[model samples]
Target chain A: MWRDHLTEIIVFSALFLLVSAMGFVAARWRAPKDMAHLDEWGLGGRNFGGWITWFLVGGDLYTAYTFVAVPALMFGAGAAGFFAVPYTIVIYPMVFLVLCRLWSVSHRHGFVTPADFVRRRFDSPVLALLIAITGIVATMPYIALQLVGIEAVLKTMGVTGESALARHLPIIIAFAILAAYTYQSGLRAPALIAFVKDSLIYIVILVAVLYLPYKLGGWGSIFDAADAKFAASANPNDGVLLNANNQLQYVTLAFGSALALFLYPHSITGVLASRNRDVIKRNMSALPAYSLLLGLIALLGFMAIAAGVKPLPGAKEGSVDSNTVVPVLFDQQFPDWFAGVAYAAIGIGALVPAAIMSIAAANLFTRNIYKEYLKRDASPAQEANVSKITSLVVKVGAVACIVFLDPQFSIDLQLIGGVIILQTLPAVALGLYTRWFHRGALIAGWAAGMGLGMWMLYQIPNAATGRKHFGGSAFPLADFGFDTKKTIYVGIVAVLVNLAVAALVTLALRAGKVPDGVDGTEPDDYFVDESDPRVTPGPERDADSAREPVA
Target chain B: MTAPDPEAPEAPTAARSRAKDRSPWNWLLFIPIVVPLIPAFFNGDSPRLFGFPRFYWLQLAWILLGVTTTTVVYQMTKKKRGGGR
Candidate 1:
């Protein structure tokens, strides 16, 4: 099988290596005076312009996992899979309203992570620790899922081997290159490489949506094919159109996913790395263009069904991996060389986000965990060193997740990751707007929401892979004693429960006259822009100030 | 920690008033989020366009709606040049 696709293997290898080389050279793309500081290494100097931020954030959010999985969901589940389309569409307006404030306040305070903002806003190290740990935990499986994206493309190219080590060798090699360049150049590596990734993704998706549909008859026939496939399927919920039972799930899942998209540390990393508030605002308006792309991408799943593309067999007997649907479709339809380009698109797409996520998670650990607890007096250089090392370690752990655990387990964990990260909304997203929620209340809210989310996820079952628990994100309304069979997104329920707990606890604490933590930020801090007099200077300036004699 | 500037008291109030003036436009952001979630607006298969179902094409239209709405709000609320409040 591998021998049959020499043209593809060569093209994929050439492009993959080209991006990896670009990753190393990116260290000097916008070289800072001090390479050892967090701002320089972890954030690309916090000065990415509109174009870079647009591509970087788009590449970060629309991961290779999304490229593979969203369509795969459409291939398997039908209309429910289209939830991703609305999910991406709705996220921009929501973030446009909120994230500029975060960017402004973060610039004012020199905050590298959301936990940093939480730590100061609430003046509670414990709460910051919770946010930081949740971020790292939620991010790990997400990075692993990026690996799953690359692996799907590789598998479709017939790159598998007999031994376990052999099967994962290609992924390990690709990630090792990613980990190396990310270590050398930090956030700049992914920032630089995202250009290539997005170009490939746009070209491949546009081609597939246009050319494949034409070849497979037309859009009407594609929809008809999907409708017929779902109509003949055993499950009543599967179709091109929403059913009564699944409609609630579709809406709630889309909404929940939109809310959860930016809460992840990686999304925040991209947002904070921008040059200014206007950059964020412009990107917010412009970023939905990717949603248009994502909508087209999601339709590839239906196109696959229309083209009669069958999925490759899974590791287990009689099971098939639906994640391979898009890759397999590309393989069967496109010429060998173009198929390799699509494969490289997916492969490089994985690398860009994996690098950003590791950097984001590493920043969380170094700032909130390592500096706050382990070594309070660590300098900026030491902090950068820790983050650089932590990023490598995180990637190794993500690779281990793919190697040791079943890929299905990582997908399940990624679902739970959205829920877990949304638990931070009250503390991170809302706290940006108001500090009314008390510190203790926020922590309690997080715990309650996380606990309930896990419980709810455990109750839902996936009939496809025969998993009894932790199978999917759609929770049944009947489980809450409602008579209806309609299911809703678990994240939506968990977040509402989280908000209620936080609000009630806040009220209780206020009534008891419990002293809330000091608010370290002022209103003016949230409005500070680039080059503003009040904006915090970089660590180099702080160092210079410390070295100066007292007046 | 520095001594309070003479302009401090009026600065926040001016900013506050400006925010209040623009707050109505911010409400437009909710249009995109809310409109797409309403099943009745887009839950049907009739009214196909370009060989696509109404449910599918309308969702794509919502992306355009969101982009346009956000762009309008962004333009309306954009801060003026020369650092004016």
Candidate 2:
């Protein structure tokens, strides 16, 4: 038993040690003489161009969350979980259209995060604060979702074998390493490690999707196996594709996820760090290629059924923890050493995004909330220091997510998070195009939408975990007792509500002679190139950084 | 180090220079990717349509498809995008 897991522990631990050693030395990877400014610490010298940004963003977005949860969902409930594939496929076109605009505007102003863009675009620090807070709030559970992937892998290896300490020890040790290096190196460590993380993942997914089916049976036999079991399955809850109740979930989940995908500050941070608009444009078109891979990866869920891969005991017999399905599929079916490779891919996958999320969260507190409220005159070096320290704290919150919350619940929280982050779409995405809505109305709209989204999610419950938090619930079938099964994305519904409220209030405020915040951007700035001298680094204006280096 | 300007008047010239370096194989990569997609959209279950069962043939055709698509994209693109380089 230990042999199965031992190889994994050795390989993973050694790799982590090696990565951390590299991380401690990473400040010297391309160490700037004095690494005190935001440029050096926060954005990895703000010099990642087309290829580097490609690998970094690709690695960051399609993470351990996609790896473990997609298959687990497929394993548990059949086709309902495969929405991740199409969502990913569709996401490219979506981002391909929007990301370049963001890149241009961000480059023009030297915005480090989306909130930074909002503050500059609208000339409203309050609006940027709302966006920043939304980003941090939405991103917390996402970092936790990465840990769930590691835990699922650990649980499969039997390292967690009946001991609570065993179950959690790996997570804590790994996060400790993560927090340490992230504190020391900022984005460079993850950016560097992303190369190895992505290579291993491509190898694992390419091989497993190809090899596993061949080993079990051909695709024919595999799907035959899946069809046989699902048809005869004991769980009445099971279906090959989504039913009426689950249909809303599929659409809403996909749509909400698309909106949320770019909205998350971590995702935007990755985009903003690109060296040019063309890089963003190229990556947007290119990133969807992962969707092809994702579709194949999602097949692992159905493949699990075909292989007659059963979930472990303690969870429902039919409903295996969707989180464990991918790890179990690899561990059980692949060779021991190779499974170690697979485990490493997943383990490393967790780190890059966690680092980015922590960075994004810490930047928010330091820039928008702290600098805006607490210390207006903090130095670049001081703000960078605060962001670094706060990054460690953000990681602790992610760790708590794994230690306490159910893995399945984290998935749902991510979904709810999508809804939460989407409320800022108008103030953020739409505001990129126009600042027509008043800042007060936008804030009011955000509060109303967020409140209503949470309320709706809270009222609905999943039969699986049976809790009443943001994660376990879905949008109810018929609001106000309407009979339409035609449901909506919670995020979309929230944003619509947000937009309506903002417009109404904007009209009301205008009628009442109230003042709206001043706009700070010029028309050409939206189309500005990376060489525009006016780009202010961070939020401050100084000779060293007309744009805040950290921003 | 270059004056921290966001606008580059030189960008248009750079983009034009890049267009010349674009890979000839870029369109070729799509062939492999799109070929199998065709069968997936159509019925592979028509045994009369092919030698192997649709299910049996789906991914084998796809491995070729992936390799072809990757190769074509690799051949055509000006720079390595998805880690091949």
Candidate 3:
């Protein structure tokens, strides 16, 4: 078993080296003279054209967790896991209209984070601070999910042991490589590396999808076996597209996840990095193709079950951890060299998102919270420095998540993030059009939404451990005496409360004669294109323009 | 003919009026609006939808049909969101 994982070790090292080497050279790919600006460090010089933006955002949106977890959920719960497919398919066109406008306004105004939009659009720093804090807090568990993805791959390769120190060394080394480049090269690294990451992921997934099915019977046999297995189960509602008990959870998770996808700081980081409105628009139209890929990947769960693919050497029998299902399938079915390629796909996938997310969160801290409150006159170099340090600290926190926290709990934190960030939707998403809601009311609305969402989330109970921070098992509807055993997304319920409060408070505040915050933008900003002079601003000062790329 | 440079002078009308000829039927995007209810409206165990079981095909079928529903709804909200289709 010790020697078994050597192939994964070598595969992982090669991928790390490749992404890192590309990261070192990325400053030249776009070749920004000034590394001091947030645009360069945090958003990859804000010059990514449509094709680069497509691959970068595509890699950013779909992560190692997605590749592992979607299939894992399918393996455990029959068809219920397939909700990811419909949610992703629907998310793009749903947001396509809104995001282009956001891109337009942000580019025109020099906004680095979504909170910048909230601050200006609502004309309230309180609203901006709330959104910034929500973005950072929500991103923590999403980063943790990447660690979970890495851990699952590690376990599949037979790398875990009773020795805790030895078990986590792979992640420690991977994150170290991740932290070094992010600290040195910033967003450019992830931008360059995403091309390699997406290429490897697509290749691995395509091979496994077609090759695995052929080796273990065919599509017809696989579906029949999955249906039979789920049919004999005790839940009784487990085998179809939509089951009665899980239907609400499915629909809400789908809609709620779609809303949350673009709201995550990393998502905004990806879009804001694009060169122009057309890049954002064209990419959204093409991005849904990933969902088509997602549908097949979710079906990998059923395929695993059909092939009678067992868990890794470490896991208990019949109690195969669903997260390891994909890893084991590749390990069992493919040759050692090919398994190495699949392992690298998952590894590089984790690295790209982890870097992008940390950078997104740090940019929020530096721009909205730090500069707005503590260091008002901080120059572009100082701002970039603050972002770099915060990125390192956030990576440390993500490592802590993998070492100590339950992976499922990390998923719950992500759900809570969706709920929290959706509060910004009314202000950020709706604010893209008009400023009908007063700034003070928007703050109150944010407070109400966050409070209501957290209270609902806290009431959820996880039966496995009887602990409750956040998760589906603890959904408050069951405890409220209305007792319908249905689970709905806390974020959806919370966002509704937020919108209602914002509307009501807006009417009240408009009557109370409250002054709204400043608005120095025009609608023309939304239609601004690549050649616009406003995009260039001025030369940002930095000391390291002449430093050699770290080799 | 000139290429009508996207960066050329913007006529104010072109900038703000992606919503110009607003038809009353534009609101019909909200129609199926409620029609996802038809399958659940029929409410059956083995009800036939065309040749296939309503249970198996309804949710899957709605996926394709839902895109049409979304495009039409977006046409109005597109104006509301301040842009073109």
Candidate 4:
């Protein structure tokens, strides 16, 4: 099998090794004087200019999983899958309005994680602990899903074997390299590598969208083929157009996902690493260009259908993994060498977000869990050391998730991941804007939201996979005694329940004269720019102080 | 730097108030979020563009609209600097 695809394998390995070398070299890209602080290691010294910020955040948001899964979703479910386009479209405006506040306040207060901000804002370590744990839990499965993206490409490249060890060995080797560089270089590794990842993705996708249509009839025939296939299908939800049953799910899923996008610790890690508010503002407007690319990417699903691309067989007999559709599509149509580049685009694409996500989760652990609770007085060097180690542990756990559990299970958990992170919205996103909720009330609201979200998810059934429950994110309204077959997104429903509980609890607490947690942040803190004198100094000054001889 | 005293009287009131004032331009952010979500507007298959259905083409168009709205808002609301970087 390997001998058959020697050309593709050689090209893929060459590009992969090139990026790994760059990952190690990235540690000295900006060459900070000291590398033993959380700011230096975890956030690229927190001074990335506009272009780096653009690529970093863009690469962070549009992961390899998105490259594979969005097209796969488009292939399987037709119009319902197109929700990702609107989801990306709606996120930039929300980010523009909301996240700059988070960036400014986090910089002003030296808050490393959203939980760090929550800890200071609500003045409650317990609440901060909840936020931190939620972020880390929601993130692990997401990192595992990135592995699924690479696995799809590998399977397409014929790197499979009968033994389990043979199947997972390549992934292990790739992630070990990723873990080493991320541990050494931290956020800088992914920041520097994203340029290469995005460039390859653009070239491959632009070429595919332009060339594939011309090869397989045209866009009109592609749409016609997709339409005819779905029209003959039994599922009411499958079509080139949205139907009455799934329309509500489409809108809510789009909006709910947009709300949840930046709430993820990785997204915030990308945002807070920017040099200033203007870097964020400029990137917000510019980043929507990726949405255009994403829209084109999603259309690859229809292209796959037009090209008659069939997914490779799965590990189980009589089962096929739809995730392999795009990879197989490229392998079948493109020549041997260009197909190799497309595969490398996907394989390398996985590395950038995986590095950033592990770093983000590690930052949450170090700041909120290890430092806040484990040792209150841990020095900066110690905190950075703990973070570097914790990032390695997170990657190992992500690998374990892929090895022990079925890949389908991780995808389901990622759906729940979005829902779980959205529960933090009231605490983190809204907290950036207001201080109305009591700390205890926010905790109660979190419990209510999370409990309801999980229970709703448990009630969902995936008919295609033949799973009874915990199968998907679309919860049927009929469960609530409604007569219709319409389903709403589980995250939207749970978040609403969460907000109502929070509002009522806040009112009762206020009427009872319960004292609120002291807000550690000032109003002006949210508007501080890079040139502002009140902004916290970067790591260089701290490194200078540490290098001084003891008095 | 030491942590600020939580009870200290608020300084930078001008900057605070300026940040608080809701610019009308900021309201443009809602257009992208709200417009694409209304199902009745872009749900049909009529008026296809470039061999694409109305639903397909319109969603892509909404992306362009979102980019434009964000760019306009960013330009309008950005604080004018006295000295360029």
Candidate 5:
């Protein structure tokens, strides 16, 4: 059995070696004149220009899980999987305006994390701690989702087994290599490897989209097969087209996900790593090119259906893993050598974002939590060291999420993470424009949103697996008296409740004579350019301090 | 520390002018975002193009439209941001 996939294993190992070498060597690439600082280690020295920002932000947003899971979602559910397309499309214009301001403010203040901004903006350590914890909590399941994507590809190559340790040992080994490189190189590991990961994915997807359809007749036949499959299934809401019941869920999920996407610590880290405001703006227009790629990749689900792909039996009895559909489809349809290259693309795809995410999370801890609460006078080198160790601990927690929890549940937990991140929008995103929300009100709103979102998520049961609760993002609208059959995305409802609570509480606070937090940022801070005097000091000071150790 | 090389002259006057033109153009950014959120417009399969359903093809088209809108807005606002300074 292993001998048949020898070419695939060999080719996958070769490319994996190439990426690991790049990860180790990246410690010295661009050499930063100073690796001892957070700006250098965590945010790529905040000097990346257009092309690097494009790829870094692109690779950061679209992950291995996107390559594996979006298509898997399409194969499992019908039109709802396409929500990723519109969400990504809207994210560009939506963030184009917001991110430039965030970049400007962060550059001026030398903020390493989003919660750093919240802490200063709100002047409330408790609220800042909440945001920091939320960032780490929201990111854990997302990193686990990336591992699930890699596991699906590994399972297709016949590397899995019946025993629990046998199934997870290969994953543990792969993540071990990832953890080592990331701890050594920090953000540079992912920034360098993103170039290789994206090129492989582009080639694999271009070939698969063109070749798979021809092998399975054509797009016409693919849709017909998908339509026939969905029509015959017991669920009426699932089919080739979006029914009236799911249309609202699709719209709300897309909009809610669009708002939530940029608010993540990793996505913001990628934006803040750009050299200037213009790089951030130009990338917003260019980044939608990845959305186009995502739209094409999502069609692989329909192609899997046309090719008559079925899920491999999972570890549990009577269980089928929907995540395996795309990987197994590639194995059946492509040549052995090409399949190996595709598998390596997906496996390496996990490395770049996982490295970035862990770095982003570690930055939040070091800047917002460690320095803020633990040691207020920590030096820059000590901060860098703390972040490096924290990254390793964060990756271990993510691995635990996959090993102990169900993989399907990890996907739903990712959506639940989305709900958790959306609660910060009023504080982080809106705080850029105005200070009227009242930091106390923002904290209260966050609590209400988190409380309601988790409660609703607890009520949603998995229809396919017959699980009790916390299985998916869709909740019935009829519970709120809209329509008995209709379901809406839980995130949209929870965020609206968050905003409403924040608004009402703000008014009451104002009437009762509550003091708003002192604004540390100047009005001109929001529009600072690369040439601004405020940004010049941080990098120049870092460079001088870096020479102290070298001399 | 060494003195950093200055790119050009900048003052509060140029910054104020840029901020004035920037705020109104942000409202125009909402067009590409809000139009796509209403699913009723593109839910049907009657107007399939190139063997793809309406739900499929129109969503892809909107991705391009969103990029175009952002590009147009960026071009309109970027000159005032950099040129006046």
Candidate 6:
């Protein structure tokens, strides 16, 4: 069976090689005159226009995980998985208002990381450090999820499992190549590679959505098959449609996920790299084109059912490996050559965002951690070098996440990361519009949110594996007695705690006559455009001129 | 370095920029927000569109709706007049 896939492997490798070459050559695609500067390397010179920004942000946001996991969830659990479609839909409007303001302020101040904006906004390095740490921590599991996506594809391709180490060898090699180009090229590598990733994904999804249903008789038969299988399952909540019990989970999950998606440093990396607010706005609306694609991609779960595709032999008897359903489905339904294209799409889909994610996390470390703490006098060149090296370290941590942890846990940890990152919303997202919350209050809010979020996540356990913890996002709303079956998203619960703490603490701090921290931003900073004269960086206005160079 | 205090006097141009920032077109941003929230109003499976469940098809339609509304808002608000910065 494995040997028969030789043609698929060759096509997959050929496309993989093509993208890897593109990743390396991207270093010179938009050659910066002074490539040594941190902004130039860390952010693709922070000047991408609407078209490039669309692809970059699309590729960054709709990751390989979307390709592999969302449908997998639909295949395994039914209606709950479709939450991703609504989440992606609402995300643009959610971010459109907030992110443009962020871009304006960050650009005006020459801030590279969101933590940089927080530090300047609240005048608290400790708060900034917490935000920075949260970003780095949240990003690790996310990058791990991407690796899980690639590993699933590789496993489906029959290239894994010679030995324990041999199983991960392909993943390590793929990411190592990712790390090298990202180290050499920084944000530019992913920006250039995004073009290819998005194109291949569009082609594969467009073809699959059109071709799959016809092969399976039509949408009617596909839903009928899905409904029959789900109805026979033990879980009463499982079905082809949402039930009273899961409907609230769907709404809260979609809303919470929408709120949390752009808070990640990688999403911000994509947003801040755009040339102007207009680019950001234009891309936000247009990028829903991917959501349409995602909706179709998710239906592959139903297609898998209609095709009678089952989990591979290695999966535990009588249970499904949800992650493998889509890959196995494609393998069963498509000819070897097109299946190769589909597999390559998922594989390369992982690389683009992983590269961008590492760069974003590295920027958080260098700008907020290394520069702010260890060496305030670091030069631009030094900063760039530190970020490049940190990108590599970040990738190593991601590889560690997938290598050492159970793949299921890595998936759950992603939700936990969202819970952690949403804690920053009070300080980072709100601070863009108001600084009324005292810095002390914001810190307390973050602590409350992070603490409560982790506790809830720890309590949820997997029924299938009998695992005691890190099972999933749906936590029982114990406070609402007799409704234990009704669960809310962990992120929504945590952010509520964050907001309550912030509000109470802010009022108390105000009553006590506590002095607020210095606000470093001006009102005008939130509305500046590229053509604005104040942002044009004259000799006297050079944003980086004040920092003293350190050896 | 910290800017002085929020209590410090703002320039007239800055105040004017703040006022202008509240464009009527900014109100259009709520469309994306409202469209997604519509699912909660009619969350059921009975009204299946072409065999796709209502809960499913409604959300998918909103995806395109979100894109269209955002595009209109973006076009209207893309050009900025004189502002404080």
Fnat scores for every prediction? 0.66, 0.00, 0.01, 0.66, 0.60, 0.57
Candidate 6, what DockQ? 0.44
Better of 2 and 4 by TM-score: 4
lDDT of 4 by residue, B1-85 (tens): 1245334443443254345435888888999989989889888888878898888899989988988998888777764332122
Q: What share of the true interface contacts does candidate 3 keep?
A: 0.01
TM-scores, each model vs. reference: 0.96, 0.84, 0.86, 0.96, 0.95, 0.94
Going through the candidates in the order shown, the clash numbers are: 0, 21, 2, 0, 0, 0
lDDT of 6 at A387: 95
User: Of the pair 3 and 6, which is ahead by lDDT?
Assistant: 6
- Which rank order by TM-score, best down to worst? 1, 4, 5, 6, 3, 2
Deviating ranges (above 4 Å) for candidate 1: A540-551, B1-3, B7-22, B79-85
What tens-digit string does per-residue lDDT give for candidate 2 at A328-420? 778788887788888888888898888888888888888888888889888878978999999999888888776766555667777678889
Cα error of candidate 3 at position B76, Å: 15
Off by over 4 Å in 5: A537-551, B1-10, B13-25
Q: What is the DockQ of each candidate?
A: 0.53, 0.07, 0.11, 0.49, 0.42, 0.44
Candidate order by lDDT, decreasing, is 1, 4, 5, 6, 3, 2
Winner on lDDT (4 vs 6)? 4
Residue-level error in angstroms, candidate 5, position A325: 0.7
User: How far in Å is the alpha carbon of A175 misplaced in model 5?
Assistant: 1.2
lDDT of 3 by residue, A60-157 (tens): 88888999998877776765676675576567666765787787777766778999888767667788898899899999998988988888888877
Interface RMSD of each: 3.4, 8.6, 7.6, 3.7, 4.8, 3.6
Per-residue error for A363 in candidate 1, Å, reads: 0.2
lDDT tens string, model 5, A350-449? 8888889999999999988899889977888899999999999999988988888877767777878999999999999998888889888999999999
Error of 3 at A350 (Å): 0.4
**lDDT by residue (tens digit), candidate 4, A53-140:** 9999999999999999999988998989889889999999887868888988888778789999898899888899999999999999
Q: Which residue runs of candidate 4 sit more than 4 Å off their true CA positions?
A: A540-551, B1-17, B79-85
Q: List residue ranges in candidate 6 displaced over 4 A.
A: A313-320, A479-484, A537-551, B1-20, B38-42, B79-85
lDDT of 3 at A477: 61
* Highest DockQ against the true fold, candidate: 1
Q: What's the true lDDT of residue A21 in model 4?
A: 98
